[model samples]
Target: MDRPELPLAQLHAFLVLAEELHFGHAAERLGIAQPPLSQQIRRLEDKVGHALFARTPGRVDLTPAGRELLPAARRALAELADGLAAARAAGSGRTGRLRLGFAASLAFTVLPGLLHAHRERFPDVRLEIREMTTAPQLAALRERRIDAGLLREPPPDEPELKFMTVLSERFVAVLPAGHPLARHRTVEVAALADAPFVMLPRASGPGLHDRIVELCREAGFVPQVAQHAVEWQTVCALVEAGLGVSLAPAGIRRIRLKGVAFRAIEPGARTRVAVAWRADDTSPLVAGLLATMSEAGPTAAPPAARPAPR
Candidate 1:
C-alpha cells in the first residue's frame, strides 16, 4: 500500500495556523502576510483531502483531521530540532555518547570536569563510563568498548594508541590520624622506605604502585607492601586498621575517612595521568571530553573518604 505524500511547507503552514487559531494571527506569528498564510493552509487542506480547521467569524475548532495531524506535526518538528541540534553539537564538538574508561583513581581527578562540561554542552548525549585498571582500560579501548581512557604514561616503544600527558598527579601519603606520619606536615618517600604499605593491585595500576616503590628505592630502601588491593577505600580501611600507609593522588582528599591523613609528599613526586583514545575512533564524544577538560576544572572535591553512600 502507498501512503499519502506530505510536504514540509504544508505541514509548517498547518502547524502555525493550528497554534494561532486565526489566519491573521498565524501570519503575524510566521512573520508573513495573512493572504499567503491562508493560501498555504488552503493548499494543505486541498492536498490532504480534508478540512483541517472549522472556522466562523469568532470561533475556531480543529476538525478530526486537524486534531490527528497536530501530534504528528509536533513530532516532526521535534525530530527536526534534534537533527539540527546533533549537527550543531558535532560542529562545536560536543555531541554523541562518550564511552569513557578510567583507572579507578583517575575518576577522582580531572575526569569529572571533562564529564561535567560534556553534559553542560550536550545534555541530549549519552555518557557512559567504566572504572578499570589501566590494563583493562587499554584492552577495552582496543576492543572498542570505550572511546577513551584516563591512564598513566605508556612504557617505552608502543605507539598504537594516541595519548596525551595531561597531568602528573602528586603522591600524597595517606595515613590514619593516629599514625606517626600524621604528625608531620610533610614527609618524604624515603621516610617510609621501611614502613609497611597497602599497595594498589599490581594488576590494576602497577605503574603507580611501582612508581611509589621506585621513589623509596631511589632513597635506597625497599617498601614492604603488606596488602594488595584494587580499590582506594580498601587501602584507606587498611590504613585505619593501623596496618600500613598508602600513597594516593591529591584527588584522594575527596574520600572522607575518619582515620585517614593525607599529606603532600616531599620532592613533588607523582604519577602521570594521560588521556588516550584509539587512533581511529575520532568520535565527537571523545574529542569533546578532552576539549572540555582542557577548559574546565575538577567536578566535585570530595570532603574525604566516607564509603560511597549506599
Candidate 2:
C-alpha cells in the first residue's frame, strides 16, 4: 500500500497545463505533442488521487484540488531553482566561507588592503579572520584549522605548505621616546650592541626573532634580552616603558605608542610577510582568494619613515 512518487516532469506538465487550461497550448509551450501532455497531466492527477482538470469539447478548467496545488507547486519549483543557483555560486567560489589567519602586525601593513579588495570582488564570500603569530599560524594551516594564513617569514622548507610573499620591509629600531638614540633619524645596529633588548620570544615568531638575533650578531654582539612580549604592540609598549630596545619590521611603526619611537636601522635586514595554505588544498575558495591577491599585486606601501621624536 505504498504511495507512488510524483515525477518532476509530471508536476511541470501539470503547472503548464493548469496555466494554459488547454492541452494544445501547453504542449506547444512545452515543445511536445498534445497527446503526451495529456498523458503527463493524467499521470499527475493519478498521483494526487483526484481529477485535476474538467474538459468540455472546447473548454478546460481546473478542479478545486488543482487550484490548491498551484501555489505549492510554484513554490517547490522556485525553491529548487534557488538551491541550484546557490550551489553553483559556491562551486565557482563566488559565495562561500573562508577562514583566514593572519599575524597581528599585518593589520598595519598588507592585510587591510588585501581583505578590502577581496571583499569588493566577492561580496558574498564570508571571511573569518583570526589573529595569530607566525608559529601558530603555520601549525593551524597544517592542521586545517584555517583555510589560509598571512604570516611573517614562513619557513622555506615546509614541503606541505605553499607560500607567496606579499610584503617585504626593512628592519627598524624601536626605542623609548626619551632614549638618546630616538633623536637620530637612523640608528646603526651596532649602537644597541650592549643595550638590553625587549623582544618577542623565538617560540612566538622564530623566523623574525632569529633574524633579529643574527642581525645583532653580524654587528658584533648578541642582543642581551631584558624582557619578552608575544605581540608587536606589546613589544612596542615595553620599549615605551623603557624596558629595553628592540628591532622590528618597519610596519611595526604603525603602532604609534606616544612613548615609543621608530628609527631606520643600518646594515639593513628585511623580513617578509607571506600568504600560506596547505599544498593539497584545491578548494575554489582558496583559489579565488589567491587569484585576487595575484591581481592586486605585491604593492603594499612600505611604512613611511618617521621623523625623530622631539
Candidate 3:
C-alpha cells in the first residue's frame, strides 16, 4: 500500500481546529474564512483516511485518530526546526573543525596567540593544528590536506593561492652567551662574516635559509655553515651548545635558553611570517578563521615573554 504523506498546511489547519473546537474561531486564528477552513479539514480527513473531528452545529471535538496524531505531529515539527538550525549553524561557520598548518618555529611565538584569540572568539570551532615546514605546508595546502598555512616562506607567484603577511621581525644574531661579540648590544652583520654558523637545513625552510645566506653575502662574505638542524629551536640549541652562531628572527629571542644570547643585527635582515590558503577555498570555516586573523591584526608577541623550549 502507498503511504500518505502528511502535508504541513493541512496538518497545521487540523491542529488549530482541534485546539479551538469552533470552526469560526479556528478560521480566524488561521487567517482564512470559515468555509475554506472547513473544506481544508475535509480534504485532510480524506488524505489521512480517518475522520479526525466530530462536527456539531455549534462546536467541534477531536476524534480518536486526531487525538492520537497530535503529539506525533508536534514532535515532527520540532525535529524539523532543529534540523534547520543545525544547517544554518554549519553554513555560518559557528561550528566545525578547521585544519591549520603552521611552521614549527611559530609554536612558541605567533601560534599560541593566534590560537588563543581564535578560540576566544569561536569556542565551538575545533582547531586541528599541525606543525610542518614551509615546503610541506605549501604542498598540503595545494593538495587540500590543510585548509590554511602559517609559514615563513611566501609563495612565489602561485596564482591558485592567496596570502598576507601576519608578522615581520628583524633578523638578529643568535650566539652562545660567552661569545666575544655577545658583549656588544648589537652586532654588525659584517662582524660575523668569518664565524661558523649553525643553520636550519634548506629543505626544512629554503626561503629562510636562502634569505640568511643572501644577507650574509650582502655583508661581504658567505657564511660558513658548520651544522644544520631541522628547526629554528634546534638551531638555537646548537648555538647555545657553542656549535656556532646563527641569524634568526628577533621574535625567537622570546625563548629562554640559558646559554644563548640574541643581539640586534646592524643593517637589519628581516623576515615575514604569512598565512595562506587556496584562492578557491570558499568554506565558511576557513573564511571564519581568515576573518579572525584579519581582525586580530599582526600577531608579533614581545620578545620578553619567555616561551618554553620546543
Candidate 4:
C-alpha cells in the first residue's frame, strides 16, 4: 500500500506532544487550544494508520510507531529549512557564479584591485574571468556568454549595454631602447610622424587604434604602419625587435620589456576603461557587482607613468 501524505502541522503537533507527554502543555507551547491540538494529533494518527500516543487521564506516552516517525519527521523539517535558506542566499547574490570578461591590458591597471574588493565583499560568489580584447568582450556581452565585462572605450552607440568608466589613462609612446627619441624625457607626436609604427590591429581594438590615428592626424601627419600585433606585450616585443614605434596606454609600461622604452607623448591623448553589462539584466549577482563598483568609486587612478628602459 502507498503511504499517506503527512501534513507538516500534524507532524509538528505529534513531535511536541511526544516531547511534553501532556496535551495541555504541548498545546500551550504550540500556541493553540488543547482541543485543536488533540484534533491535529488524531488526524496525524489516521494518516499514520496507528495510534501515536497511549493516553490515560493522568499521563501520555508514545507508541512504538510514534517513536519510529519522530526522527524522520525532525530530519524532513530540518532539510526543508536548509533548502529554504540556500534559496534565499542565492536570490540575494550572497552565493552564486558571476562570469566576467576583461581586456588583457586591464591586468596592469584597475583589474586586480577591483577583483580583490569584490571577493572580499562577496566571498561566496564564484568569479569566472575571461581575458579577451575589446571587440571580443563586446560580442560576448551581447551573446550572453559573460555576465559583465571590463573593456576599453566602450562604444557610445551600444544602447543595449550600460557602461561605467572605471579608469582613464593617457597614451604613451613605445620605441626601441636605442632609438634617438628614447633619450628624450618626452617624445612629440609629430616627431614619430615619419617613423614606421607597430600597432594593434584595428579590428581587435578599434577604439584605441582609431584614437592613436586621430592623435597622429592632429599632429599634422599620419602614422606609417609597418606591422601589427594583437596584444600590448607583442606590440612592445616587436618594437623591442626594432620593427617600429607604437603608442599604448600608460599602463602598458608595466610590461618591462628589456629592449623597449616608454615615453610620454606631447599633446596628450587618453583612453577610458569601462565596466559594462546588458542594461536589461536583472540578476542580483550583476546588481551586487555593480553596487561594489559604485562603492569603490567611479574611476581608479592609473599607475603613474614612468620612463622605461632607455
Candidate 5:
C-alpha cells in the first residue's frame, strides 16, 4: 500500500487490539463504541488482505500477519515515545541555551553548585549566566530578556511575579576588627541602632536593604546610613576602610578584606533570596530554568519595615 493511503487510526486500533486481545477493551481505551471499533478492525484487515487474529469463544490469538506486525508496530510506537520525551525535555530549557541571572556575590558561591548540578543533569543545555542586581533581574525576566533569576529576595510587591524562597542564610555583620561590636560572640541587632552603616544600593535591592532597616527599627531606632555601597564586596571594602559597619549574610565572609571582621547577627536576622519569573509566561525555556532552580533550591533569609516595599 502507498504510504499516503495508509490509515494510521486503523493501525493504532490494530495495535491496541493486539495488546488487549479483546475488542471491547481496546474500544474502551480508544473511547469509542465497540461496534465502530470492530468495523475499523475489519477495514484494517481488508486493507492488509488477511485475517490478523484467531477468534475463539474465550480467547483471541495473533495470526501470522498479526504476529509479524506486532513487534514492528510496538517498535514504531516506542520510537515515537522516545522522540517525544527528548523533544519535550529539550523544549523546556532542559536541553538548549538557558539564560540565568544572579547577583555578583551569588556567582562565586551558590551559583557554582547550581550550575554544576544543572549542567550535569542536562549536559546539552547551554548556560548563560548574567550578573545583575535583583531589580534589573526582575525587569529582564518580565521583558523576556532573561529566562530565570537567582538573587536575593524580589520586591515583595511584584504581583506579576511568582517566586519561591529556596534557602536562607544568617546575617553577618561586617565591621573593622577593632570596631566596638566585633568582640561579641553573637552581635545583637539592637547594638547597631545608632551605628553608621554601608548598604546595598537602595534602588537595586530595596527589599533586602529595607529588611535590614526594619531589623534596626525593631531594635528601637532607624539604622544610621553613612554610605550606600552597591555590591557586597564594596561594602566589605568600605568596612575595611573603617567607613562604617555593614550587615550582610554569611556568604559575604568569602571576601577577604584585610581589616574586616564578620560576626553572626543574633536573633537570626536574615535576608530572603528567591527565584523569580513571570507567573503567567508560558515559555518552555523559562520552565526549564525554573525546574533547574527548583531543583537547585533557595540561597537564604529576613523580614521587617520598608519605605517603599519590595
Candidate 6:
C-alpha cells in the first residue's frame, strides 16, 4: 500500500514559526521572507485538515494539533539525521564490521600497533580478530570467511591472495634460565647445533617452522628434535621447563615469561609478517585498514633480547 508523503518543508517551517511565534523572526531563522513562511504554515495546516495555529493581528499560537505534532516532528528529524550520518560513515569506510584473521603470535608483535592505529583513525569500525595459523588464514580469505589477515609469507603457488609486508624481525634463541648459553648476549646458531630444539609442529606455521630448521641447517648441522608445541607461548613454555632450547621471533622476547632466557642469534636471521587479503576484494574497509597500517608503519622498535628472570 502506498503511504501519504510527508510535507517536510512545510513541517520545518511550522516548527520554526511555532518556536518563534512570529513569522518575521521564523523567516529570518530559516533564511527566507515572512510571506513564504506564512504560506508554508498555511499549506501544512490545509494538509492536516486542522487549523495548526490561531494567528492574531500581531501574535500567533499553536492549536491542539500543532502541539501534538511538535514532539513527533522533532523525533522524525532526529531519526533522519542519524540515518544520514550512518550512511555517510559506512560510505567512507569509517564504520562497519570487518573480520580479520591473524597468526596467533602477532598478538605480541605488530598486531597491537596496527590495531591501535586503526582504532585511532576509525573508532567506529568494529574489528573481529581471530587467531589462525597462516595456512588456515589463507584458506579463510579464499573462502570469503574473513575480510583480511596478518600472516607469514604467502605460499609460492597461491596467486589469489595479495599481501603487504608490515614487519620483519630477527630470530632469537630462547634457552632455559640456568643454561650456560643464556649468559651470552648473543649466540651462534651453530652453538645450539646439538642442543635439543623445541619447535612448533610443521603444520602449525610451516613457513616459520621450516625457516628455523633451514637456519639450523645453514649453520652446518641439523637441529636435534626435542619437543613440539602448537603455539609460540607453548614453545617458550617448553623452553622454560628445560625441555629444550628453541629459536623464536625476536618479538617473543617482549612476552613476559619466567624461567626462559632470550639471546640474539648470530648473522641476524629475520622473518617477515604481512597483511593479506583476497586480490579481488575491493572492500573500502579493507582498503582503509591497509592505508592506516601504511601510515602507522612498524612499531617504534623491537626490544633487545634479554636473559633469564633473576
RMSD of each: 6.7, 2.0, 3.5, 2.1, 8.4, 3.3
Regions of candidate 3 where Cα sits further than 4 Å from its true position: 15-40, 299-310
Q: Which residue pairs in candidate 2 have backbone atoms (N, alpha carbon, C) closer than 3 angstroms, thus clashing?
A: none
lDDT of 5 by residue, 16-66 (tens): 999999988889999999999888888878877888888898788899998
lDDT, residue 130, model 5: 92
Q: What global local distance difference test value does model 6 have?
A: 0.85
What's the true lDDT of residue 155 in model 1?
45
Global Cα lDDT for candidate 2: 0.89
Model 3 C-alpha lDDT per residue in residues 127-173, reported as the tens digit of each score: 99998998888899999999999988585877988998888767888
Angstrom error at residue 286, model 4: 0.7
Q: Evaluate all candidate structures by whole-model CA lDDT and list the values in order.
A: 0.76, 0.89, 0.85, 0.89, 0.78, 0.85
**Residue 77 lDDT in candidate 5:** 73
The TM-score of candidate 4 is 0.92
Clashes of each: 7, 0, 0, 0, 12, 0
**Candidate 5 C-alpha error for residue 25, in Å:** 32
Q: Point out where model 5 deviates above 4 Å.
A: 1-89, 296-310
The reply for model 2, stretches above 4 Å from the true place, is: 1-3
Clash count (model 4, backbone only):
0
How do the candidates rank by TM-score, highest first?
A: 2, 4, 3, 6, 1, 5
The local lDDT score (0 to 100) that residue 165 gets in candidate 3 is 82
Task: Report lDDT (Cα) of residue 112, candidate 5.
Answer: 77
TM-scores, all candidates, are: 0.68, 0.92, 0.88, 0.92, 0.67, 0.82
Which digits, one per residue and each the tens of the lDDT, describe model 2 over residues 1-310? 8977778888888889888988899999999999999888888988899998998898899999999988888888888889999999999999999999999988988888899999998999999999999999999999999999998888878999999888877789998888989899889999998789999999988888888999999999999999999998999998888889999988888897899888888877788888999999999999999999888766644753577755
